[model samples]
Target: MRADADLDLLGVLVTRRGRLMEVATVLRRYGFASIAAQLDSAGGPGHRLVQRVTDRFIDPELASASAGERLRGALTELGTTAIKLGQLLSLRPDIVGPNVASALAELRAGVPADPPGHAEDTVRAELGADVTELFREFDPTPLASGSVAQVHRAVLHDGTPVVVKILHEGVRRRVLDDLQLLSALAVWSEAVSPIAHQLRFAAVAADFDRSMRGAVDLREELANLQRFGAMFAEDPGVRIPVAYPERSSAGVLTMEEMTGHVVDDGESVRAAGWAPDELATRTASIYLTMVFRHGIYHTDPHPGNFLLNPGVITILDFGDVARISSSKREQLEDLIAAVGGGEPRSVTDALLAITDAPPGIREDEVVDDVEAQITDHLTGGVDAIDLAAVTRGVAVVVHRHGLSLPAEIALVLRVVTLLQGLAADIGADIDLRSITRPFALDLARRRLDPKVRLGRAVRTGRAWERLAETLPGELSALLDHIRREGGADLRLRDPDGIADHLVDGLLTAALVLSAGELVSRSVPPKLGSLSVPGLAVAGAAWLRYRSIRARRAGAPSAAARLRLAERVIRSARRPGTS
Candidate 1:
């Protein structure tokens, strides 16, 4: 069972010794060769010798396996945390690429039902009641078992059907240990590697840590159910399962068992009298409504998560969801528009606006990537654009620029990708543009409503004000860092000129906000009642902004920003310089 190990005959040191040994064992078991060289934190002649590892060794079993297969196998062997990590990676085709991600999609975290009566014992302990007294009939067998909890169907004393979710014994402790390991690894990765820093591994790890912690706690799911139920209380088209708080506790939750056929079962969907076309359009609308109107949504859009009947769609599982702020939603709208319009520069601009690009990102390079993406996949035109390709295109650009997206935005994109996949699975004739157009129009109307416009204008001004206030402090920090690091003998060109530019930018920004305020209020000097002063102010602001932009013709591009960030990192690497 062992492959011949390469001997280095030197010593390499490592902390987390026991955990690292376990990890190395798993990695080696799964045929991951060059383990010491690839993942060795401190690489030296002693890396293998200190670790008693090989410089190169491949598992004969995995030599013919795809990279993804090897990864999936390794992760599966690692259990809960790794399975969840694989599931998350499956959603990110942009990071791992389509093939690898697709291969990872098969990871299932289902555990054997709570070892017979152990689940019942835990339920009684958590809810302070015996199963027989609480429910008219409690099923001993779990309907579904996950790494976190087990769900069993039960009926209340009132004969109402419900599902009782009981947390697995000590799952929290195991999950916590894994999350700690993951978070530490993320920090270490970011500290040592610029690529990991650009990818924001630390941020992703933190977010995943939060999500996983929430997952193991039944109360969080209870809260999510209550929040979603409140949101959809009046909407007949979309049904959120009702929660039974009286019967719930921190480790257990009881909820209405919604009855409908899963959408992934196509024949059942048809037999249930749901027209695929109508259902498809309705599903998209519901999701869009969640995004544009509700500002929050169930993160998972798998067809299996949706239960459909003739006139309604039931959304299951509130264990995970995402929320977007108004500003983020608007940025998403802009990105969608730019994607559909077939303008690479606009797409690039919108993408940059939506993501966390470095200070001096190269727009030209982003535009070129976007242009090629448009040529490759979007040239089928708006109505026929392959959204999956667009998603990949976006990932490509972001990765190419060493940029990172907000996790919510990435989840939204994942939802869209999943939704599109659902269309094909259910045999629905879908025109992506036509389906989105109505929602887009409604969003515009909602945005342009007088009250909404006014609110937006007010928020916009406050945001701009904050930016203006913070800019000098941020600039000072940057300069201080440069000086402290002795980076390029720090020099300034017309430092006070920055003050003038800031003032001009703030003034113009205010003028624009004022114009919106005027438009919203329909102030005096009317074209009929159209606020002539507002129009005039808007024009002036536009002109001023154009002039400022024209004068500053040397803005750094996306590529330049990336390079600059790298240089900054490199310069900061000097020993005790700062």
Candidate 2:
């Protein structure tokens, strides 16, 4: 009953009517009256009364701006949460289209620091102690201010230099309110707008919710710092900020002050004792190692986030990190390898395999698109590489095919694009293919090692063993239930084909496992980086697996995409609303 009521409350835009009026006003001012109309209608009768009063105040000239210009202006004027959304959208050309994404990319986060004494009071409240008790000297002035938080420099009682981050007063409640509006709007759009449905705005709204909540909490940032500290503990070239967990709380973060220059002004960085080219190289190396070697990395790699010292580099901001699984990493390797190899067919195949391409997508069109991209940006030697162009090309190509890269994958591309831009800004020459190809090769060879193959085979075998052990019991339970129901008519869909596929899968698995077993024992017949007999067995298994995939290719399963029930949801329930 409570769950049903929660759903009931969530479905009504009138619950958040005041905020909706605010949002609708901004939407209309920026030539997005159509979107405002949707929100107004979603709010039932009350909004129309409010809408007329608000509409008289809006000027018509704002609608004369270009779509991208209007959107950028609207999001900027909407303040913190909206600007953050625009930044997020900047990474997704597939959703907002290239023009808007480009404009959104220019959106900057700059807010006036909160009133003085906020950091002290927040620290006192969160830490359960006065600021003087924790730190000998706390600067009232902020080092910098962002949409969500502002940084204040301080000195610990023990005289350790540090920076204190304080969440803006009422920022959490404000972000939640904004996200609620966005999520409700997304839900409404999915139901009424075909374009929004295809773009999965509801899912995007959910992402914004997660991101905003995470950003609002300082603990998540503290934990990320610790993780990165451990990750780069041994590296002399890079430094992760040391966070003070004992003094930190969800609303306040205190970490070791990293004293260096943000790489924006090339002269200052050179003055700090590192040349621009060297700094860029080190930054690129650090990011590449984090992505290729660790499979997890910081998402924001702009010049602002990197701090340069004489011989050391400090990375700032930990709230937004993206992790790719090992399988995803391998898929990325395949895609990168295809790009580096200049094989359009291979690139198309890898992209299609990794991305969520819709059913009935024309493969040849995808290939042609990819081929054009490679020919334009990658055909020239390493010096001619334009990762930014290549990145946009991939986004355009995928969007054209009605496909979307997984959010994490799109972020990875965003990172690559940023790094390339970083390199260019600092006048550094970077050949991405050269930097990444060696790592991909090493990873591939490592995967083929006997120890790796044997470990995987063992895990697979154990999984099968568990399934085999439980199958009979599960079957008995099902049969018993059917018997209690007075027997059942079991219908099968092409049972012979199913059985054939199952048998082929098992046989191929066995052959691969056998090959791993032989290789583990140091089989005499050897090929370069592999055992000859094991290689042959694995080869046969690979062929069989390929054949099975080919046979099943035409009859692809079409997973349900439409979410009518989900879209039917109304506006979010506000804080004081029933």
Candidate 3:
């Protein structure tokens, strides 16, 4: 009954005639003329009410600010959905650009809280009980309200002090509607932009959909919390909130509440007589352990989620997390090695294996740019090298290469960046590179360890054994076909024809062997240092060179053309092959 009422209120709010106009006014006030224009353009004259509101509140001056700041303000004005997008953007500096990503990072904790009654009603509906019945005591007001949910302090019936999380009223519907609108905009942009071939806007929208839906699911959030808690169970310095398995539902989550001052707050740490720098370093080590050692990480490690106590840092919010498998973990280690070694070609190849990069991007140029940025920080003043600058540099490299990071990589970058900020707050006299290097090196070594190598060898051996068993049968069948097709008496008299036939047969055998070898070799496990886009260009370059070389080598016409035709056909079969 309570759920029905809550949903009814949401329905009314979404359907009300004045609601869209309210949203537009907020957007304009926040300096989002471009987005407002897109909305108006999509909605037509009926949306004039929104347009008029936008016209009244908008400041043309704000739009003229740096592209990044403008976007941050715009999302702020557009409310939760846009802010959620900004949060996603914060993780994806590669896609939104560094300037924008940095600004969005600053906006993560600023989302406005819904009215107290609305939040209370939401909690009641989601928990399927009144607050009093579910908790020893429940705070009516939210401790924090984020894009997806509001969290309140409470105690479970079992006397465990926990946080009760309730999804924001109508968040699901609003997200879906916003996603539909964003998808439409992407489609329109692709149709009109000359750069559409390079952008892959549709893919980005699809990714956004997947990320947001996962974030909004409370059950998934609970599972992540439990999973992370287990990973850190033996670590005395880190505390992950324990979820109440019996209480959590799709829209409600109950988890042990962790209390500590935020590590980013230096003044508070100073007041407590604690060493802030030590706390920062310890915090960074914790996240590094989660990412590089365990292969699972808290995706959203913005300072807000990190709380510092005397000997521990408690991580809150498991809604945004990434669990990388062994294969991807190995690839990431390789990517780090490629970055450290400054091998652009290897980086490019590794990046291509890991991500979907844009076409026509130059591998060497991207690698040079990334290397230059990291080298500058390394050789520059030690005091000057922090996580933020390195991250911004990485974002720049990602942008120049026209490659967006996968969600997992983006999350890792976010955690690293936040650690840098935490270190700076605590007066760490260390360079981020100094701390990151050891951990990264250790991970890389493990990635290349005998166990990893043995695993790769075993996989390859299995494939080879299968091929060995199958090949003789296949060859015998082919020989039988040739025999049945032509009795031994049938022979070609022309020398050129006979030579052509012999060469063609040999070439066929060689092609089969080459293909079989490729299949037998397991895919490389590590991402290389190059951006995905760079590798794609390198691949295209290789194909074009092969085609030109084959034509110039003075090979016979039919066989040469046939090989060329075969290459083209094969390339076409693979998506993203130029």
Question: Which rank order by TM-score, best down to worst?
Answer: 1, 2, 3
Candidate 1 local lDDT, 125-152, one digit each (tens):
9888889989999999889988788899
Ranked by lDDT, top first: 2, 1, 3
Query: Between the candidate structures 1 and 3, which one is better when assessed by TM-score?
Result: 1
Per-residue lDDT over 341-420 for candidate 3, one digit per residue giving the tens place of the 0 to 100 score: 54556666666566667667777786677667654564444445555766667677776676766666667767777766
Best by lDDT: 2
What TM-score would every model get versus the actual structure? 0.74, 0.74, 0.69
What are the runs in model 2 whose C-alpha is more than 4 Å off? 1-12, 33-61, 191-194, 454-578
Q: Candidate 2 deviates by what RMSD?
A: 13.0
Residues 1-578 of candidate 2: C-alpha lDDT, one tens digit per residue: 33543464466466777877787778776656432443222344555565566555556876455666677888888888999899888888777666667878888888889887888889889999998899999999999999899999999988899999999889888888888778766777677655566667778889778888899999999999999999999988789999999999999999999878778756777877988767766677788788878988999988888787779889999988878887788788788777777788988998988887766888999899998865468878766777788888888787667776767777788888888788778777675555656776788787898998998899998786565444434443543554465332211343345433443443444334443333444454454577645654665566466546745674312111011111111101112111
What TM-score does candidate 3 get on C-alpha atoms? 0.69
By summed lDDT, the worst window of 10 consecutive residues in model 2 runs over 564-573
Candidates 1 and 3 compared by lDDT, better number: 1
